[model samples]
Structure formats: structure tokens, C-alpha cells
Target: MKKQLLLLVLLFLGSIALLQSQVTGTVTDEDGTPLPGASVVKKGTRVGTTTDFDGKFSIDAIIGDRLTISYIGYQPKEVLINSTIMSITLVSGVQLAEVVITGSRNPNRTATESTVPIDVIDVKQLANAAPQVNLNQILNYVAPSFTSNTQTISDGTDHIDPASLRGLGPDQVLVLINGKRRHTSSLINVNGTFGRGSVGTDLNAIPTAAIQRIEVLRDGAAAQYGSDAIAGVINIILNKNVDELLINVT
Candidate 1:
């Protein structure tokens, strides 16, 4: 009787092991594109796995278990494990505002640490916000203090638009590329504009693709960089980490 009772207990334990199931799924975007690097985790548990290159994933779970899926730039999802296979779809999330860098010759300073108000725009954010290929137009919309308008028929000035900061002349706003002084445009704005006699830098001369990020110092820096930076200063940092070729048709 003792041996028979021990055998019954072993069988019950074996049945519990067989009841546990393996769950498999594929994570995709709303458009059905496979989203690699998406995370899958068991709800209220530490067990998790990231989707493979093909957006496929597998995890050990049982029936009635809840799985949570998430990815960057996409909405998270939760589903009950009713079936062994699941096809999870995630929607795109709203784009967050880019953070700005402030108050330091060193580019590594955070926004909280600096006392001066500064605006920083990354290349990705600029490309998305820019309506046209012109760099001046991008800054006009992104920077609150900067302003520019496309000229219709003003000879050579029409090609190069004048830009100003804090309602001041464009020349008063110093331009810097990679922390160095950028040359001013030869075409001075002799027309009736905010920057009438000032020869400002041709902001559109530099392609948006080549830039890594732009830091605009909203405060006056005459004591730091001389009279040219009376209104403010703009520092355009070039892209140094180029790993892949980017082709822009428009």
C-alpha cells in the first residue's frame, strides 16, 4: 500500500509538468512590418524575451497567463495566452519633443545643469520638421526666436534668405560650424528686411544631412565670443558617426 501511494504521487507531479505550455508569437507594426527588438514579458513576472530579427518570439507560459509587448516609438500591447500562437500588433506612438543642450563649451552638459536657456535640435528632428530642403526654413519653424522669409524677386538676395534672432539683425547672430566661426554670405541684405545692412551666413549652404545636431545659445555671448554674438550664437555640429549611406530623393 505504501508503494502504491508513492506511485500515485509521482504521476500527479508528472501531470503538472505536462500542463505547462510554450507560447510563441510574432510582433509587427500596424502596417504588418516585422518589428525586431520588440520586448515580450509575462505580466507581473520577470520572465521576458526580445523579438528576433524576423520579429518572432517564444516564451514559456501557460493558459490564462498575460503577456505584455512593448517597443520604442510604438504603443505597448497586452494579451491573454488563450492560444499557443499569437500575432501581436503594435501601433506607432506620438513623437516626443527633443531635448536641448545648454551652457557649456562641452557638448555633454544636460539641460537641468545649465542656467542659460538654449535650444538644441538633432538631425533626425530637423529632417522631420523641415517642410522644405532649406535649412533656414527648418530653423524658422523650430526656433521660437529665429525668423526668416523666402524672397520672391530681390536679385541675388532672393536665393539666400535673411534670418534673425530675437528680432535682431542676422549678422548680430553669430554662426559657428563645429564650434568654429562660419563665413558670412557675400550677398548682404540691402533690401527692406529686418537685417538690412547685415551680411549674414547662408544657413542653407550646409546640407541638413551632414549635420549631427544644432545648438542655439539664446542668451547674449558678447563677453565670450566678441561683438558678433551680441544677439546670440548658433553652433552647428557636423555628423561624425557615419555608418550607413543615406539617400534622400526629395
Candidate 2:
């Protein structure tokens, strides 16, 4: 009885060896790009190994055993271990939730490359170099297309010293502070000033010390910025200096 039991145990072990073999394969995407660090495991068992940088793996398995493979950003796959060599391709999975882009300080896209005619003026440099004392006076000397005049006799409209651009009326040009519309006085007719029939803002109120730069768009933008910006657009950017003090001497 003991000899019969020993013979049966030996036959059972030999049959198990005949059914098993070594399997090898490569894992990749539809584009044939190797998927490094991919997971490869046998079904219903913890025995498994990960693919190398070349997306190749070797594992021991029996005939008809199931092999599961998976990777990050790719769909999972399963294959029957019928052949010694195999090729696996995984499809893409998941998607990016959101994406953002910013170009505020991109040096390649400077003012010179603008499609419209634009004049970028450094306020701090001009105030220190030029002899002009006010914003109106400084711009008058630098920009020939811009014009401004003091009013004394027309409906009390001299407070703002209305300005114009591109030989257009004073009300035609639009003024913006930090890209927002600056408030202006009510419409009124002028008799003794070049900016006659003006409804303009107070340019003198804005000190040069508080400004960083000025962007002058000398183009017809009525279709884009409404009728008020028909002649052009003047945008003022404020100073963003940190941990420093600025003193302007008159």
C-alpha cells in the first residue's frame, strides 16, 4: 500500500510540470510606443512582474492561463497563455480635466509685433527725462497725432483740458485706467478751444508717479470698442513696484 501511494504522488507531480512553460511578450500602445513600468500578472494569483523600460516581460505560466496587463493612462488588457511569445497593445484612457495658458511677460510678443499701430510709452522714464510737469503736457510733446487744449470760456469745460487723437473729436477717443473706462464730465460745447464740443476725463488728475506705462493704440476701433473708441484707445497701466518708494520733485 505504501509503494502504490508513492508512485501515484510522483505521477501527479510530473503531469503538473508538463502543463507549465515560460512565457515572454512585449507591451505597447497602438502607435507601437513601449509602455514602461506596465503591470503583468497571472489571473487569480499574486505571482507577477512589471515590464522593463523596453516593455518586455517574462513569466512562468501553464497553457490556457490568463495573463492581465495594465498601465497608467492606458486601458487594461488580458490574454490567454497559448503561445510562448505574444504582443499586447493598450488603448488610451482618461483625459486632462483643465488647461491654462498665460502670456503677460512673454518677451517674444512685444509691442512692435502688434497688428495695430501702437505706441508703448514708459511713463517713469519720460517724466524723469523730459521737462514736462503733467501727463497732458508730456504726451503733447511726444505724440504728434494727439492734441489737448485748456478751456476758459466754454461751459466750464476747462477743468479736464480735453484731449483728442488722430485729429478726431475729443469725445471720440477712449481713455482707460488698468483697462477700465475712466469717468468723464458731461457733454458740452466749447467755443475758444481746439477740443471743441468735448466730453473728456481729467488727464491732469493722474500723477506720473503712480503710472508705470502708457499704451496708445492709434487705429480706428469703432467696430471693436464701440463708437467712443472710434478714433483710438489710450490705456494707462499703474505701477506694480514692491518694497520701494518713489519721490518726484517739482
Candidate 3:
């Protein structure tokens, strides 16, 4: 009797595993053109895949699986799959509005509600502009008050000075990557004659292709981001949806 019971349990488990299915399909834009290198993720989970050159993709998931489809310059689409061979159509890209977070720690709050002034750069704008190499080239000249100085250094380290937010030193200005604080460069000094110094972000650490948007707050935010907030804050938001095997055709 014990041996028979064990066999029944094993068989039940095996059957359940087989019930889970795999889903696959090609992704395309509304114009019926193939969208290669598009991101296809299982909604809520990190499991995902990118479309190949032919805009073809395959992924493993069970029935009633929720999948998210996203591509740069295109609107994201989510679908619930109950069968095999699901073709997804993504819409034309929409221009996203500028979103800023100022007062308090709440992300839902906008710049209007806060005491500080936050500058928002939409991702669509950056993609359309097609910046080359470092993001510093663009961020420095684009914003009103911010200034970037590129100093050529020969000390074996890649030398690109940090950006100055309203002439404040680099150390005084806090830099956040993907909304998380990153370590400042230990090599250079951002402080100048002014109580604030000449510090800038090493844009090389971040790739323009991966950037989603950049937010610059032009007021004092010591209370929100802590001590480094003395000068101001620059937040670099990275895209979480891209899945391209980038091949730079030089």
C-alpha cells in the first residue's frame, strides 16, 4: 500500500509539470514592420527575451500568462496569453510629459507641490536627439543653470569633469543613478573658490542608450537626500525595458 501511494504522488507531480506551456510569437509595429531587438518580458517576473533580427521570439510560460512588450520610441503593450503563437502589435510612440519629484519622499508628488524646482528631460527627446558617446555633452548645454567643463587629463584615468548645478561644487551636488545614490569620484576635487566646488558627473559610467530620462533639481534638497543635497541633485533614470544585443556598426 505504501509503495502504491508513493507512485501516485510522483505521477501527479509529473502531470502538473506537463500542464505548464510555452508561448512564442513575432513582435511588430502597427505598420506591420518587424520590430527587432524589442523587449518581451513575463509581466511582474524578470523572465524575458528579446526579438531576433526577424522580430521573432520564444518564451516559456504557462496558460493565462501575462506578457509585457516594449520597444524604444513605441508605446508598451501588455497581453494575457492562453495559447501558442501570439502576435503582438505595439503602438506608435507617444511623447511622455515631464514628471518631477520635489518635496517629501513620495514619488507620486510633482514639482509644483514641492519647494524645490526640478527639471525633467523626457526619454523620447533624448532618443530623437541621438546623443553620441557621453551624456555630459548634452546635459551640460541643454539645461539653463547647469554647466559642464571637460578637462583633458593624462593621469591614466579617463578625465571628464563633473557637471556644476548652479555653479555648486560636485561633492556638494548629489548624483543618483536609477534613483539610487552612486559613489562620487574619489580622484577629482569638485570644490572651487566658492563654498561650492567644481564637481561633475562621470557620464561615462552611464550609457546614453540605457538612459530613460534625467531629472535635475535646482534648489536645496538637504532634507530630502541628506548632506550631499547641499548643492542640488541630479537623477539619472535608466530604462528597464530594452533588450538589444547592441552591435555598433562603425
> Which candidate number would show the highest TM-score if scored against the true structure?
1
Off by over 4 Å in 1: 1-110, 242-244
Query: Roughly what TM-score does model 3 have, to 2 decimal places?
Result: 0.47
Candidate 1, RMSD to the unseen true structure: 16.7
Which stretches in model 3 have alpha-carbon errors above 4 Å? 1-110, 130-133, 153-158, 190-201, 246-250
Model 1: per-residue Cα lDDT at residue 189: 79
Q: Ten consecutive residues with minimal summed lDDT in candidate 1?
A: 103-112
Choose the strongest candidate by lDDT: 1
- Candidate 2 structure quality by residue, lDDT tens digits, 2-97: 999999999988877757678899999999998889999999999899899999999988778999999998878888888878888989964668
Better of 1 and 2 by TM-score: 1
Best-to-worst order by lDDT is 1, 2, 3
Candidate 3 local distance difference test against the native: 0.73
The TM-score, computed over Cα atoms with residue i paired to residue i, of candidate 1 is 0.53
Ordered list by TM-score, greatest first? 1, 2, 3
